[model samples]
Target: MEQERDFTELSMMSKTRWNDNELRYFQHALSQLLPYVNPEGLTILHEINKEMQNRD
Candidate 1:
């Protein structure tokens, strides 16, 4: 399988620019990636989760 790229870039982005659906999609994708992601990916996941929470 091809190696996944670093998720740290996602952290640099403004999640606010993403629509709710997009955020949800990323959230799901990140969840699936959780098992294989590195520490930075975990941070990206947390950032997405926080963004989602802020929306609610």
Candidate 2:
């Protein structure tokens, strides 16, 4: 199986800006994978959730 890259690092290194839908998609996807993610990935998911909450 292909190894999964760290989502947080990928986000930090990317220059592309995320739209609302894209962010929602990522949040949903990450939430579904939370159970399998490492501690850092979990932290990233929480950070994403917090940002989403602040936007609301």
Candidate 3:
């Protein structure tokens, strides 16, 4: 789906300008999407986790 692709692309970005709330929302959305997403989605989740860690 286009939505999945869009999220995948956004997740791959090296510099995201999302604020704390936005990051939290994205993280939650990605988590909910895991069951229906592809293997690469796991990688995206990992990247997002790393971003969260880097911020903290």
**Best-fitting candidate, scored by TM-score:** 1
Candidate 3 lDDT over 1-56, as tens digits, reads: 22233444555566355456656777898799888878877776777778788899
Please say which candidate is ahead in lDDT: 1 or 2.
1
lDDT tens digits by residue: candidate 2, 1-56: 54444546458743244445555777899899888989977876777677677668
Which runs in model 2 stand beyond 4 Å of their true positions? 1-10, 13-17
1-56 in candidate 1: lDDT tens per residue?
A: 54433335545668775567667877899799889989977876787789899999
lDDT of 3 at 32: 91
- Whole-model Cα lDDT of every candidate shown, in order: 0.74, 0.67, 0.67
RMSD of 3: 5.9
Error of 3 at 37 (Å): 1.7
- What value does the lDDT take at residue 18 in candidate 2? 42
- Estimate TM-scores for all models: 0.70, 0.65, 0.61
